[model samples]
Target chain A: MDRGRLALSLIALAAALALPFVAGPFWTGLATQMYIFGLLALSVDLLLGHAGLFSLTHASFFAVSAYTVAILQVRYAVPTTLAAPAGILAGTLLAAVFGISVRTRGVYFILITIALGYVVWGVAHRWSSFTGGDNGVTNVPFPAIGGVGITSHTQYYYLVLAVILLCALGYRVLIRSPFGLGLRGIKASETRMQSLGYRTSAHLYAAFVLSGALASLAGVLYVYYNRFVNPVASSFPISVEAALMAIVGGSGTIIGPFLGAGVVLGLRNWVSSFFEMHHAIMGAVFIATVLWAPDGLVGIAARLRARFSRPKEPGP
Target chain B: MTQLAIEVGALAKVFGGLAAVDGVSLSVPAGERRVLIGPNGAGKTTLFHCITGTLKPTRGSVRLFGRDVTRDPEHRRTALGMGRTFQITNVFPDLTLLENMTLAIVGTDRRKWVMHRAVAAFADVRRQALEGLEAVGLAGRAAQPVKLVSYGERRQLELALALNTRPKVLFLDEPCAGLSPSERQRISKMIAGLPRDITLVMIEHDMDVALGLADRVTVLHQGRVILEGTPDEVRANAEVREVYFGHG
Candidate 1:
């Protein structure tokens, strides 16, 4: 990390840490949502931005994890110590199975993931006896360990902020790693990568599962924060929105997804207050982003910075 | 007394009722430099693909170091000491040359799976990457992305990517496919200077580079080997003139 980026991250951390005490409850809650959804988007980008696999089934892992935590905790009275890990493990296991989808590429990969996601959604929506149908599993409390537990939403927000911060740091390391570069190489040219002796399919499969695990982590965070799990959590729209968040912010950067989540959530919150056609507006925004700023908002910001900082000297 | 490095037995590849490579068999001894030359659409590239496992032969088998690898996938072929450069300059355009070399250096090894450590932290990888770039005369431009470099430089990077994999048998599909006279000489010289311990099979349209570099030449016409011999025999043959040299 450069000095400027490090300083910016420190400032963002400080602001996030101080948000609950400094800002209103609504803003803090919104920030928490942003972090959670941003993490989800980051997971999706692991394949989308790096491996060039556009998966439409990440929400399956997210909802599977959330539902696992909800059922294990609410119905079976499982402890947080057991339920949280089980939730993550269950979601990660689903991701491992779905990792087989990496055998396909481009449109086929996208279609397979879509079908896989729908299977999970169908189960969550139609399996009423166990899933509770549309009402979902409720009366879920905040996550706690032994006697030390979250008593307020503010505390949960801080916990989520902390976890996401750690995740971002880890994600940064992963992207800068050799394995990460390998993913980007595979994205650029799979044949070339194979010629260079990389087992491209295996590389992509690993990335898919790791991405799923991250999405599962996001799901666990979501269940604890929302206090419930429903079929909506597993729906197609959430998956699309998570991907859109990454694209809208910037697909390749770590902070981009979070910033994108904030933008999407903030816009939805503000726009729906007055306009009934907010979704149409969202569509327009996405189209504009794709057309005018294909690299997303971060790329725009970088370009602007480069333009402004260019030397004023006359000679080249 | 040389061991056979690559042995192909009656290989055939068919596409939509047309045979691209039909009933071709060739054996290359270890440490020999062999070149394949033919007119356009003579199945030279198709033959290269079949040998490298990029395109599976419809019939027959391929052996590497006397081991049958006919069923091996392209990547497994790579791991078993086979490496190739494409006719087109194929490389990671968005990555810096160092990164490109880094992938090649660690690709055949387990280091490509180290997800926790930053690539910058791998001092050996970085050093070897720089050295690999240096071998291609690209160390000065190590930090530049592949797309920013000239086509000739990308071609060099292509050869560099293949070479860094430490293959026992290396295949070059027109490594100097598009280049100026000077750039072509430079690349051909680079190929000629490679350690003779590694087996080399190359496809070249430039007969001067092909005949000059080959220990022996194989000429293909319409997917069958028409002739195989020393450069002098291939040059003076009346049949080669009609089909390949265009005049006796």
Candidate 2:
């Protein structure tokens, strides 16, 4: 709430609002993808950064939502409006069931979540009747809100931006609340928290359900914007991408994941044009970032600004 | 008659073939200052863990304030007014001393899950946390992170964490385990000044400190009580002198 933070937030908001006007159509399309990815990254941050859970199965939730929208629209002839909520509800229920069981053990917890992600992926691939299987569901309808259809690319871009901003605000409020502090305490030391009469498992289960719902929202947006749903959307590599984005931006901080998503997603779109080994380059960059800025880019930037702005003491 | 703060009846804990806590039974009346002393590996810590519900006993029951809490979890025991300090100091290193104590007090209040309420707005919680720190003579270092404080101060912070919960029964595990003589003396005075209404049970290896503080003493050997009586009676017992105190 300081002047500096307020100013930074306002500036970022202005940039996001102005992006469509300044960028070409192709770049505008890519930025929209980044915003969707940013929402997914923020959800992952809630678990990994705040709750001290390391997960590699969030893509299952994402895929669940995307597939629900695709299948409902294509097979069951369900309207887009109803499908969105239904998909989110499905993802939340699935996540809660998995979260309750997996949140018990330590390292094995993470492994089980990964295995669950693979299980979902296998189902999506093998069940061709409903999912369209390997080829995916294509020509999904555009979202229409209150009879206002969003068919143009610019309209879709603004829709993604609006959802991202709303979710970001929600994340901000949640993290500043008492529940957020409990999650931080859970992260710092579970044994100490338990001794203070906190049932940590219940808190973790709720967080998982909430995070899954949010990830599913992103998945719904992705299906709307692209008019397609693919098996790769729920693949392990995409889950890894979400984790890396959360880390690169800064985990617990609200804006960190969004900033991380913008940078990495932007870089991928820019470099894929000419490079054949973009994945290798991204891997190297990830290694370097981990070594040099373990706290992420925001932490590095803060340290640099502090060094120059603060008064220095003379050597004795 | 005063209520029994803790009642352990025929408690036994077995890991594989070894009996960690073998058939231990004792009772401490409300407001009594009791100490258990023995050599290393005498199952003192194991008994503490069982009473606190950290480790489930294979047999017998533990009752706190006439409620059977034998199968309860550690958190449930904590909620029922049983405060404990670990043998190893456990304070939040990254958080300030005030924040560490505040967490305990807030957690104990059962309002920690109120997501929208700001912690700073809770004036009563802040006041109680500060009072707990002051009780341990840590008021001056309240703003400093616990990691920045000395080892002795960190130990005091651990005690402060327990006190903020306002428990009816306090279990101090080696309250002076690694303290310097001066630090040990200060902690001794602190413990001696606690409200008489709070039942105190502690495990101590320092015989001199235990004798000075405890109204009654129990000596354990290899997982069983060898002697139990008033401090004077325990000191006079022949078997305790030969087997534990190394004198006859």
Task: Give the runs in model 2 whose Cα sits over 4 Å from its true position.
Answer: none
lDDT of candidate 2 over A72-134, digit per residue (tens): 877787887788888888878788877865455668877888888898899888888777899
> What would the per-residue lDDT of candidate 1 be over residues A1-316, giving only the tens digit for each residue?
6999889989988999999999999999999999999999999999988888898999999999999999999999999989999989999999999999999998999999999999999999999999988989997889999989999989999999989989998998999999999999999999999888888999999999999999999999999999998999999989989999999999989988888999999999999999999988789889999999988989899999999999997976
Q: What is the TM-score of chain B in candidate 1?
A: 0.98
Q: What is residue B45's positional error in candidate 2, in angstroms?
A: 1.2
Considering summed lDDT, which 10 consecutive residues are worst modelled in model 2 chain B?
Answer: B109-118
Question: Which candidate gets the maximum lDDT versus the true structure?
Answer: 1
Supply the TM-score for candidate 1: 0.99
Once fitted onto the true fold, the runs of candidate 1 whose alpha carbons sit more than 4 angstroms away are A313-316
Clashing pairs in 1: none
